[model samples]
Target: MRSGFDCASFRVRCLHADRGGRLSAVERQVERLPEELVNKIQAGEVVERPASVVKELVENALDAGARSVHVDIEGGGAGLVRVRDDGRGMSRADTELALERHATSKLRTLDDLQAIATHGFRGEALPSIAAVSELVLRTREGETEAGTEIAVSHGRRLHLRDVGHPRGTTVEVRDLFGAVPARRKFLRAASTEAGHVAEAVTLLSLARPQTGFFLRSGGRRLIEAPPADGLAARLFQLFGDRLLEDLVPVEGGADWAAVRGFVSRPDRPRPSRPSLRLFVNRRPVRDRALAKAVSQAFRAVGGGDRGFEAFLFVEVPPHVVDVNVHPAKTEVRFADGRTVWAAVERAVRQALGEGVRELPRVEVAAGRGEATGVAGRAAAAVGTFLDRGSGEASGSEIEWGGAAGPPDRVAEAEGAAPGVEAPVPVILGQHRLTYIVASDGDELVLVDQHTAHERVRFERLLDRAGRHAVRSQGLITPLVLELPPELRPVLADHGETLRELGFDVEGFGGGSTRLSAVPAILGQKDPGPALERILRDLADREEAGWAVAGTRDRLAATLACHSAVRAGQALNRESMSAIVRDLLQTAHPTLCPHGRPTVVRVPREEVSRWFGRTGWRRS
Candidate 1:
């Protein structure tokens, strides 16, 4: 036991100990680097991300007024990013002047940042990117046979070299972040880098509907939007066939002048509004007012809960909006933010009212019975969801199935959890070959036709997997996944994660992914696309800030969920039963990792109430 005075003394002593006057001073060290070193440092920021380099080159191409933009990248642009456009090329004077800091063909006065209309008006972009990487720019006039090539690295102009190039400008950046190893280490694997690069290209394409675009990574074509008349056609390639039918054309104007394009499908929305690409005057912008208006408009059409992929373009006069707010050139300041907001919301409201085309529901083969595999979870809860049968829809069969259930019983199962507080699965009257289920009282549980089967499949799979814990099923023929080279390290770091998920990933000599074994649950599925989907999901998750990969077992569970049977699969009763039993035994039987309700429930009492009756009063 210490006295209060002693405790006070102890506290005072600790603060006094940290007092700088009581500590000894160390000698100071300072040094100055040459001018050359400073330029290289500046270059590092301009070309920090792969997208940054691409933006710089593309801006030059756009500012040059290229109708067609072709971007080719390797390793997600980490290895190399090349942008070629059919625009006015640089002359000897232009090439040399372009490399100089603050040299520009766009801005004269600092105030010009106010009415900036070009895709990019920043004069710093070119020199900044040039200072950090091995940059080569070759340009030629349309009629010229020979072109001038200028090479730069770390801000120093390599001796001017003459080269033959097409009648346009081609800018190539290789070995990004090479000068700064710290930044290089931050880059994701090449494949992921390529995906980001692809996203950048998509943004650019959306902004310039008139530009003919061709994009490829690792020699594989990502997009080929070759001068299409409408944004719908472009979206069809990036998203899917859904946008074509769901897109609602918006045509309206406010005092500031506005043109809007929005997609209105309630079923397909992302979790964030960042997905909404809003542009002003051919420049992609992330405006709070515009985005809020779009959100409100969407909420009006379909409640606030769901998300829709929207591409809304709003064009204001150059004088009305200021584009020079940020160096990245993403945000904007409209003359009247509220006016722009009102116009954007009005346009979307009118468009949603106009209505888009809806496709008829086509039932395909989905498991209604026992979903005993990885994809069978949701299917087990309800019943087989709608499935697509052999169709000429796209020369492939689309299977759809309903939740294997008489949807009402899911409520009873959910209720049993709070009252009983045990592992027992409360069964409701089973009909339509489905188990309507809810778990932990509140959260919904849904079983897919395939996942129901997967539970059973994995049970059998694990039983077989017990002895060695290393089951390698060699494919008849190995499948190859072409990825950008930047992602090479991520694969190397998470090798065990791949193996545990039933992916026998072997590194092909070059920067490529070779699959020898795939998860057993994917039954006869093409391993290439499956792996890519999983990888894409992983990459997307990385963006969402969930990067703690602690244990292989947990990671395996994640991959298993990803590779498991989906709800939209087909199954029979036997498979569904195995899945139901397995889920009941599993510790986490309530929700998927993503927090989506596995299934929703409607109790018998609730169903009776709908019929103007009550379950509590039995008369």
Candidate 2:
């Protein structure tokens, strides 16, 4: 009995040694992750959110030559996302291969990567999306009589069957990131996600104006844009015709490249740039170099502070621009960035010179909708957010919506007409000769003289821009000035724009130009210093590799700055009243051309609270 027990103990020790050997092996060795796990890890990079999934599927449809594409989303695309397209679909075998990583027919050789024209060449989008969601693909190829339908969930194929379908494709994704709940927690609220999805669709539709696009949420159609011939027509369809007054068409080309797009004029500015789009080879991309060039061109014209919007389309040889910079394919690197920058800058300059006229405002169909789907999301994101700088009004004759007026309204209410204009404030006096102090019975307003005048002049310039009728003051003695050789091109390129701004410049041989006239708004001030500053601005711009184009707005601002009523200049009450009237008439009365607040209002109640004479709310 004792020997039997000893043998049993020996066997137990042997078993423990064997287990230890196995553990040692495991600790020393490294094994590749399972295929499913590897695919899921790859999916983490590509399928970031519902919007990323939407962007990929839409691009795939577009690459397939879809004439009309439709997107449907629910729960901000977390619950379900379906994309339908009338494009050339794939066969059963190709559809099966599409679920696998790195399986794509878009590229063949190394050279194909350099000149990628298709929106999606990496086959990663499909496999990555399928790895993390329940994906269903229904496709009917042109050669096949029946359609092929495949179901995949979490990188596993559930079924592949023949189904009846039209000659197109449909992709549906359900419960995105369901297999990985950790990723799902990172998603934003439904409305914010919907906004991002809507923005993606808007940008894609803008890039492909020839293709029709429709987006819906919860079975309600939000966007329905038909195929259009030009960018203007497409923009009109997406944003409505209010943009007709804002957009300036810019077109320019050189030997190797061409650029054509629309830029907003200086007067029409936004706080954020939601609509600024840039495309290369018909693919939408966010290239900083191109955007910087465009911004610099606009700034050269004093439209920098207002925050401009533009849709710039650059056409270059596909090989010259690399579209494979990022996995999402939203960025591109140009081969010769200087050439592209020069082209874009020149185009904007020419377009600025040819002033944009406000076309008849047409009703925007997208604007008429509740805040639910694509229309609402896109419109809300891009609509004018009336952010009054400093959150105060400038001029005294302004209406403060429905809640502003005298506290004792009954006294002034007798026999007053309902539509009567708000009474212009009485000018109390000037503060330090820089600010105009005015009282409207409730509050005292302080207006910055320089900023106020700048705003007034900018509006006048915009109004005259359409008519090309800026009054000119002919120089009593024609100022013939010798300019540096570098500034000669600035004169030649912007000659017409300068003339329209009331500068009559004639160039002569050997770096000499004669200035016969200047803007009448300059009054008795010397034009010599202003002109020199403008030349210096142009020269500095050129030195920075930006085109010295689109300087009309800048020149106007320069002229206004130099000619505005100086501080300490004593003005009579009539002049102050006239200034106040003009100030109220200007659009964007709160901010100057440079985006600084022109006025600060101090309420009488606030002053009383500050003196501790009455109870006040502590902040």
Candidate 3:
């Protein structure tokens, strides 16, 4: 036993000595990396993927004062990326220096960094990109008879020569990350990478509407925008007239900081916050506070919990905003974030208020031949009824089959237990063709007609969907829709779900779709608007990380909202009565599918107290 223990101890000591000797042999030192390695490392930071390469090249073209820019990509920008721009080109000397790290003409001193007006001030784009791929740059100035052509391979200059070229710059990058297998391996599928590249180009095009931008991938033209007159024209060109009509112009701010752009109407909200695009000094950025402010402003003016779409541009002194916070330059830090937030909020609020005022008012025919605004007429009728101390009216009166009751009549009257069904109330009339004014014995109940109908439709749709019994209604004349290219794939992906919901949709080619049928519940209503809303919702759901069940539920709710009666539509007594009856029969009568209140009850005592008649009752 003693000999065995001694042998084990000796082996352990030998192992420790071996480790110490190995540690002592290795030197602890630091040294600068070689130029090639340095460039490759920089590329890792600036060029995350093919999309990053496209972004840097495009920004450079725009910064060069390019009036027109054309981009072509192959293999989702992995095999080749070429950007040709009609911008100021570089001389032979400048072209050679452009491939070197930390070489830029946009900045001279440290102060210049504080007020960067150009997008390529960092000067790291060229060298960093050249480090990981084969690059060829051909540039010619207006004064030069011949252009300079420089070829580089993995941070090494291969050749420089004079060639005949136009007065612009063309950068062709091939085999991106060819030398860095690690990065190349991390790239996603070709289609996904192509999507990212398209998004980058779209953002840049949106920022510079005055410049013509064209993009082609795999020999297919993806985006083509001519020089637009302004932002509105650009929007119309990109998204078509349907989306443009839904946006209202927003303009306001102080001299120090100003904001201008377009915001979606409160009634036409999007499904996700990413729809809100924000730009600071004509540069797209992601700022949470600014985005939140826009949402808050929308909510302040009756835009509910749903997401909103906005294109807001904030202009401030360049020094007041820091664009160097990230290597990608997609985020900005403001000097006075609070002030900026307040300005955006105020501007959006004012624009929404003005938009609401400019909207066409609903007119209702009164006694004789006179016509008055819905709100004015509704108020006058309510006042007259109160002064006369009566709950009865003649024309337009909708009778209830059961005893009068509120949304929670049993609880309010007899203090009954929860879950007891409320009696159907008498539908007195409609207020502004929106709310159903009802009399629940001694209470005045206001029911949102749209929401009430929406609830009924939602419950029915849910039941039908669960049982896989949704009915379809064919149309005589098919509807054709023009959608953005990126959204076309969404339809194909959710084609099964849409068909289950009673829509017969098929691609009509080139960003157009044909709708041959729709859900029978929609009746004669125009499905164009509703279809657009559903498409947008589905697109948002793709990135929302929701389960399949949640997505189906959302689809059902959206269908119900579009199928139900609109707020401004005039409803007859039968329609009003049907809505009230259907709503009461629903499992959740008090709330809509989106969880908004469907009915609001003003107790008899509360109304009487306002008129100093609480202590008196009819004898």
Residue 510 C-alpha lDDT in model 3:
45
lDDT of 3 by residue, 495-539 (tens): 677888888888665456798888776653456655766665555
lDDT of 1 at 152: 72
Cα error, residue 341 of model 1, in Å, equals: 1.6
Identify the leading candidate in terms of TM-score.
1
lDDT of 2 by residue, 1-619 (tens): 2232223324333433454444343221112234553343222256788989999999989988999899988877888889999899987667766666655667655577788778876666887787778899999988689999988776666777899888889999999888677889888655445555766787889888899988876654456678988788887766556555567787896657799988876445332332368888888888777777776776565443334578888899988988776768888888898998888877876676565233122223443323234543343233222111111222111111111111122113112324535566788866544577887778877887657766676667756866887778788888766542224445555677778888878775434578888776654244543464455454333323321124576656544544444333333344555456567666677877556777788998877678775644435
TM-score of 2: 0.55
**Residue 223, model 1: Cα distance from true site in angstroms:** 1.7
Error of 2 at 286 (Å): 0.6
Give each model a TM-score.
Answer: 0.62, 0.55, 0.61
Candidate 3 residues lying further than 4 Å off, grouped into runs, are 1-44, 178-181, 269-274, 357-480, 488-619
- So what's the TM-score on candidate 1? 0.62
Q: Give the alpha carbon lDDT tens digit for every residue of 1-619 in model 1.
A: 1132223323333433454352234221111233443333222134558877887788778878899998888887988999999998876555655665545667555456567666655556666666567888888866556788988764555656678988789988888768667678989767667766766777888777678777777776666677767777666545545345556678885777686676565433223223577777777767766667777876676434334456778877777787766667777777788888888888877776565223223322233443434434454332211321111111111112111232222222212223333343343322333343434343334454233433333343444445446344568888766543334434654677677656788766544568888655443445564555455445555555332234353344344454443433433334333355555554444443433333345565665677777755656
